[model samples]
Target chain A: MKRFATKLLTAVLLAMFLFVGTQGFAQTINIALANNPISQALNKLAKEKYKAAGVTVNIAVLPENDLRQKLTTEASTGGTSYDMFFIGPYEAASWAKNGWLENLEPYFKAMPAAKLTAYDRPDLIQGMVGSLAVKGQSYALPFYGESSFIMYNKELFAAKGLTMPAEPTWDQIYDLAKKINDPAKGIVGMTMRGAPGWGMSGAPFVTIVNAFGGKFYDMKWNATVDTPEQRAAWAMYKKVLRDAGQPDILSYTYNECIALMQSGKAGIYYDATSIAPALEGAGSKVQGKVGYAMAPHQKMMTNTSWLWNWAMGINPKSSDAKKKATFDFMVWATSKEYAKMSVDLDPTGSSTPPAARTSTYALPAYSKTPYAAMTVKALKAMDFTKPTIDPVPYVGLQYIAIPEFADAGTQMTQFLADYVVDKITLDEAIKKTNDVFNQVAVDGGYRK
Target chain B: MKKKNDWPFILPAIFVVAVMTQVPFLLTVVYSTLRWNLARPDMPIVFSGIDNYLFFLKIPDFTVVPEFYSIVLQTIIVTVVALVICTVIGFLFSILLDHPIPGVNIARTLIMGPFFVMSTVTGVIWKTTILNTTFGWYGVLAKSIGLAPVDLLSYYPLPVIIFLFCWQWIPFFVLIILAGLQGISGELVDSMRIDGLNWWQSTFRVKLPLIMNHIRVAVMLGLVFIVKEFGLILVTTAGGPGTRSYTLPYQVYMQIFSASNVGRAGALATMTVVLTLLAVNFVSKSMKKNNL
Candidate 1:
């Protein structure tokens, strides 16, 4: 009986130790992310670096639309499946307004001064910080900030005897594209997103509209989609895409455009500045031959480039402990320390996160990199406070920061796509685009 | 006048069915009567009394791309075209498979292959591998032949979607019609042949008449399934080149998930249920009249 009792006690003790050890060793936090290069890089670092720091990070990377839908569904029900998620500026305000995002200001304040200084809150890009905040309260921390710009092949320009200005106009870009286009040689001169969704065509197209002096809505919220500026922008976009764009451009999104540029097939790619890392990465064919320029201008009353940031927002429904863990991971992942560590891991600066912080950008190694320098210049030039030439009742450049705008923007993209392919006439496309905007305006109570 | 105690045995099944099917439907009906926007929590939910329904049904100006009526018409047209193509092709394939040709088993497997593929995979394969303008097989073939590759999805979005649906579901119809063909005895076919009927006459007058019930079943099943075809359309073209291919189900999905207008989505769902019920009822009545 004594021996049996001792054996039982030993078994119970072992079980308790195992349970406590597991609990202490592996506290997991789930992160929902969009499947972008930045997110993938973060996931790699989390596994390699943060796993040893006592928290197991589980990341679910989904496509952009799928991630949006999943986060929206979870937010609607106040679900706790995800402890944190990546959100765009367009969704930050709406999600914050809906009480789905945790206010990150308090968390930042609660951190020790030493830690705060290390994180360097003020070092963050002002435009990015402003865009990720709602009513002056930060709700998310930007993982990487991006603005639109034109990336071209310097070698291609030299071969074709073409001169691209540092700040080229849309007409100039179009002419360059036509000159360099060699369909017989299987090279596309220009590549842009033509996929049907709003995030695909609508993103770049909105910047075009802004550069042409088109407004989504007037101060009174009347849809201005039928304006002469919008028509001109659409006409230019359609003609250029048809004449110089890659074949089956309708299926091309950002990834496809990047692939075309990297494979030395495209002469010029006008897209997000964040693609710099991929374009200059080790595997890139045009790494040494790529050139950066400002986004093309038309009227140039306002900058044509858009302001976008992929930021991490904590779920409001998470427990305080989970929130703390999430914030810790977020700060660490976005900190200068993390950026330095990333650069050390890959000395070529390809793995370095887009410098959200001024200090990170000031790093001697990062500042000297061509892509990094160009990206910082573009980021500094963006004015999120006034993204368009005309005053509109929204705060977004690529997208209007309203929930209704998601639907309206997607519908308008469909119309623009059809118009580009000659599936519908320009007039019909404009009418349909205006109708969608008007309906959204009235239904959202922005107009009567 | 008999009081059957079978209720006791079936009560659990009835309860399960009610819980599985009726509760969400009832919730949807309740939700349809309220004004609920998930994005606008400041706007309190209140009784709106068919406002959402009316809003959805309201006709836009003809200039608009997706007038509500146009979506409905397009949905119907796609469903009909898909059904006709699936039924005819499936029946012919079923007849072909019944023959004792060499390598017939392998051919049968190949014919049944698409049915096992998921809808999303079907859409992706068609969009990326088959129909893509640049890198797809169609483009490669077109280019190799020294012709400009056609952007089939952009130019003919609806027809291409219909083709995808038909491709995926035809195998299902084939299996059904093939099973129905097996039920007709060899003796009956022999008698029809001995009765001086030509091959075409026997097929039209005897075999087709016999399998009319199977054809009806296939059509009804296709109608029921095609109305909920969201994945294929969502993955390819996204109901576009301008709402030329937008269906009612895709519209409802956009209203709920994309637009966050749950009340409007609910209203659309209620209408879809009603229409589907009416269609099922009509199909059943026709089957009864034919004594199948």
Candidate 2:
């Protein structure tokens, strides 16, 4: 019995080795996606399509921060764990310069059909792709682009006899919020993200600062946030968020704001345009009584609505064969036909690709949706020319450029959080943010 | 002749230990001293020496201190608080369960349910369901009681996290101490009773003395758990409300992943390791003295 058992174990080991060897030759694409509704739909579509193509696609859906952490770790370590990743323009330029991403210029050129040729790349509304590309090589493909807008409760506005314009000023928005705010009835005048992080609080703050004509960095990479424009913007934002926002606004992210607006607690939600579809869904309590308008501005009409959300990128560490497979999969998955298939499967219209393709937006399917016309108008009306009212060198709409921006930005964010929590003064926070980053710049061999 | 085969006995163990601990530890030490940004791995990893360490120390956010000192303070706070709370609660419950009661085992097992939960899940459940200021169940209850809802996160983050840590770990210590309690020969209690010793006196002089070693072991284990706790902090506060609850592991995470300051992050990790070693040594020395 012992001899037979030993023989059986040997046979099993040999068979496993052979199976692994065969499987090694088989092409498998490892795709990492953000844990968003649209990405979930895309994963479901990729599984079916990749299976038909005699390839296996392993998908890992992670939250925004985890996805960033994992992808950054993998890319930096030159690990080939992910063949394709859903990234954003935030790290695209820096990652591309670091040679962590495969330049998709050649691939896109080879497959002209996959490229947005006749779709007018310049008029795509969000010109983040231009910012993401270095010299002439496109590093990451744009899956979706977004800008901020004001989503308000129409019924509450009507009840309060408030009149909000198609494009209102900051003062008007503040007055409207003050009028509609009824805390006794469990309604807040306004709700925006006040969570202390670059992505959470800083994104909207940057836009407001831009509208008020703030500049983060000067011509020579010196810290320039102590300007009058920035101080005014920061002061105003703190006042509004503190008063009209939920008591727990300090912890609010995009999802929290969405919940606030959808549940009839918020009179106005200033956030991403992508939330319009979600807000207009059948499950939403305040669906039909919602209105969309441009992001409120101050002295200038310019407000930077960033091209945010996940985009596909190829891994630089992958083998040539793996790269080809990844590129092919990206093209196939992001193709117009595939998007249509995704929409068909998930008819909520949440699965449709948020692209700049005029042709795709002009589709009868997209046009039939209530959000289609407004979404198109919002996309078309976005101004990339003047991202900031004040002069600055970088092109990022919602963030500062430079590799050290993450660290410096986080330090600044913590300072702001402290100030808001009354741990420090706003003037003290400003001085600290500017001085710390300026010293860091000097230390990193840059003139400040 | 028998000693010649000792190499064979130790080879596999050595290999496993190296793979699991030594290699990664060595890498962390190397990365901590070098200007190695993972996003730009191709760039020649420059040797910045103690500059990264100094820079992290001087990081002008809230406080100015060496990364080593900051991590040591945080590690002590988390471990010490968790150790005291877990030991007190665990010992109390273990005595309760030592008696003959109907459904006692069921009650004990239900209390241990938190030990079965993933740390991340624990953080998420607490943050969203129980501790959420506005819409959470806890908030709803608070509002129903005609009280202004409390943002448990804003004012009381560290204490709530400590409570969570204690809630999860107390059951494990209970299980350990219960086993120790059961092994304390009944004859000792009988002898105490014959001597006319009260329950409190017997527990203090007899039962407690016997379980000192077990208690030490539980404290040591709890120390290790608290030292490595990052998931809860990361998920719940992300080390927030202005860095009040930032622990050693969470600091390392913020430095490495969040700030992408890998060199400084490495310095933080090295400091953490040194502190963990010192803590373990201290615990073991105390345990040896107690045993003596």
Candidate 3:
């Protein structure tokens, strides 16, 4: 009986090893991504497409901040738990500089020339490419990109006899908000993100600062938060949100803004062009009733819009086999064919990824979409390399490009929130923001 | 009875406690002294003693203190105020529920429901269904009554957070204190009644003394958990209108993720641990004195 039991145990152990060995030989890649609508659609598409090719795709969809934290920890430590990271322009440039990302240039060059030509790298929006590149090497592939724009309720505008301009200045926007604001009708004039975070209020607010010709630092990296242009930008944000924004303005973020606009309670919304999908398609109460305009500017007309992308990057420490699989998946996901294919999922082209490929805008399914033309125009017009009208050292339009910007920008966000809510005086806010920025500069050893 | 060789049996537990708790804490202390930053690869991570702590602690001028001090003050105010309310109101609820009233079991279960809820859900539910000005119950009720609904969260952030914290935590205080009240002998209650004590005197002077240990246990547990409350704050006010609602743990988070400064985060974390220990120690001592 003892001998029979021993033999049975041996057979079970052999079966387990066989199962484990088969798993090891199978192709699989793990991707960490932002939980956005585009990515959600991509997640479904890739699971089916990759599974057919005998490659397993495992994806973790995380909120923006949580994704950043997870990726930062994994990349910084050279961990290999994930092969691909869905990061933004801010992370791409900084992580590339840190040598945590796999440089995709060599891989692109090694691709079959026919495949490379089919990829048509130049057809990508130059701003999106620029944001994801360090020096000359591309670090990530843009799945989707957005330049900030103004989306307004056409029904509300027509009702109030307010015609939105082809191009609106900051002052004009404020005036429009005031003219269209109807508290009795339960419709507010504007919706802008007021919740505090570098990515929340900081993204749009920085562009407003740039439009007013305010630089966070000079060429020599001094804290420039107290300049005249800076003050004007500050006052504009405060006055606009306080006078015409939602009742719970201080607690508002882009998510809240999207909900308000989707509910048809907001007159105008100033945020990412990416929000066009949620407004124009799939459970929207205001479909086809929304109008698009360029991002409102002040002193700097050409670069008022902020450029952002949720793109995929390969971790350098990932196995070569895993990297290859990850890149293949990324290419197929971002290809023009994917845009055409997304129509099966959503006929409105709302779930279709936007602004990555120039060809995507020309697709018959996408061309008729309301936001396509304005999106391309805005994408072409934005120059993140020359963010502020005045020359500065940084390369980001909505954010400062230095690694310390996240921390520094977050500090400014708090001060801005306080200033907007009448919690602190303008002078006090300026002094405090300027002081914190200076301290970050000194601590980061950037000023030296 | 002869003592057995218990060291052999207890050694594994001691090893686990040292590895899981003590070693990580020591590592944090060591990391606090290093000048490590995850973002800037050009700058080499090296040992830079005291600089990280000084970053938060140093005040070049008295007129303008660093944000660390303000965040610390905010954390203390929120935690202390919430704990006090939980103790007072929780005791009152316990007294009311202690009587032989019909359907009291249902009332006890309903009161305990909030304590079992996750903090993030509590924040989201309250923000959307209750507090929102345009759509929430508060707004609809206020408007129907012909009054303008203020954004209570924005206008009064600290007070709102305090109230939410108490709403969730007061039941926990009752869970422990009510057990203490039940443990009091029935003969003791009869004697107190026979001594001609009024309701206030009986409940406060007699029953309160009996439950002092339970109150201490509840307060200590509440302080430890409430001091590190982050999720609710993140969902509710997001440590804003400005950083008026930021706490020690929030600063630690900002340092680690936003600043990507492991050393500074470690320093802030160590300081937080020390401050929490000081608070717990103070509460323990006072509660012990009360017991005596």
Instruction: Return the top candidate by TM-score.
Output: 3
DockQ for each model: 0.60, 0.44, 0.65
True contacts kept of 1: 0.61
Model 2 regions lying over 4 Å from their true place: A1-26, A47-51, A109-128, A342-348, A368-374, A380-386, B1-19, B40-44, B58-72, B283-292
Candidate 2: residue A141 Cα off by (Å): 1.8
- Residues A245-344 of candidate 1 have per-residue lDDT tens digits of 9888777878788888989989999898888778887788998788999998898544679888889999989887788889999998889898888777
lDDT of 3 by residue, A4-78 (tens): 999999999999999999888878888977867778888888776544355788887876656777788888878
TM-score of each: 0.93, 0.90, 0.94
TM-score of chain A of each: 0.93, 0.88, 0.92
Q: After superposition, which runs of candidate 1 have C-alpha atoms over 4 Å from their true positions? A: A1-26, A52-54, A112-114, B1-12, B60-66, B190-198, B284-292
Q: Which structure is stronger by lDDT: 1 or 2? A: 1
Q: On a 0 to 100 scale, what is the lDDT of residue B242 in model 3?
A: 83
Best by lDDT: 3
- Model 2, A156-183: lDDT tens digits are 9999888789887777888888888876
Poorest 10 consecutive residues by lDDT, candidate 2 chain B:
B62-71
Winning candidate number (DockQ): 3
Ten consecutive residues with minimal summed lDDT in candidate 2 chain A? A117-126
